[model samples]
Target: MAIGITAVAVPLANADVTTKANPEGIDVSSYQGSINWSSVKSAGISFAWIKATEGTTYHDSRFNANYTNAYNAGVIRGAYHFARPGNSSGSAQATYFASHGGGWSKDGKTLPGAVDLEAGCAGLSQSSMRNWILAFYNTYKSKTGRDVVIYTTRSWWSSCTGGWTGMGAKSPMWVAHWGVSSPSIPAGFPTWTAWQFSSTGRVSGISGNVDRDHFNGSAARLLALANNT
Candidate 1:
């Protein structure tokens, strides 16, 4: 979800300490290549969001290995889909994502799937974009019986969706804002469920830069989310 955009960092004096208290996580894709899941778990990473499918045709080549290995290493993980609204209908993309690695189970280690919505509005109007996203969320929920997590930046959400607040109650927000003490919340969401605070974070298992995240709760709360309790 780190597309390399710079934003003004929020001036929170205790942001670093406050963020560190929450559960730590990361999001990875084929760009990270092979990873040592054991080392990653040992590094105190509680969860991960692995890229799964993009649009209706492209699937992340490393999704299977990362998905299986991360689970085996005892890291709670979920899959994510990159939105390509210009290429296909949201329903089709959601179906593709679910059919691929985005399916969820009741097992304690699998988190619900997430949809990345950072693309440039896909040439659609605000209303149309909102509908596309709703179609995706509805289809994904029907397929997995879980509300899909929505990932986007505050700027993109405001510009593209006209800061629509409808999804705040339905889906959890995973806001991405790099180099910030605190992430900027989008219009509808009262607070962020997950925050991708840095795109250039390094982990022992990852080769280069990986996206660093924090679940906005404790370990038990994260498990509750995974188990849907």
Candidate 2:
């Protein structure tokens, strides 16, 4: 999630290739406070992933406003869950996410829900962590009829899941590697579907630091993803 983390300047040499072709976006949580979606859209932001739920019981306090306002302002938006593997079963957390705000719809402005998979591996071994993630994906799919996006980093994926490659074919990857020319693709994915390039970004509507991202393709491709076309 990169919340509360120090931001590093992303190198222009590395970011130019992706940002030039990809749609600019951001990910926000309650930490971002109130946002002006119209200004965000006017500032050339195209999409967002807002924090929805974490673990099994904690819903992001600002989720509803962020989700609805982003959509109303014409920014393609989606919800994400911060995973908690050690506290409960993956299925439980996915169920909680879907019921809260992470459920997907066919509307052209809503992206499929994502699961944030970082923060110390949740004390699980590689194999257990892999199983837990698969369970969450499967449960979320069954509930929403859409594949859950996997949000992670190369180092975390490698260390926690032993570089598992099974998810590449089943889900889209939102790889996060801050301050880089290009994000490193995790083991299971050949390429990133979305890239979080910097955590210290300044967007028009967001008052504090926000995580900046890019959809790996054009705007139409992003629409296709949102609509599952």
**What TM-score goes with each of the models?**
0.91, 0.91
User: What's model 2's TM-score?
Assistant: 0.91
State each model's CA lDDT, in order.
Answer: 0.87, 0.86
User: Model 1 compared with the native: what TM-score?
Assistant: 0.91
Candidate 1: stretches off by over 4 Å: 1-21
Alpha-carbon runs more than 4 Å astray in model 2: 1-20
Whole-model lDDT for model 1 versus the true structure?
Answer: 0.87
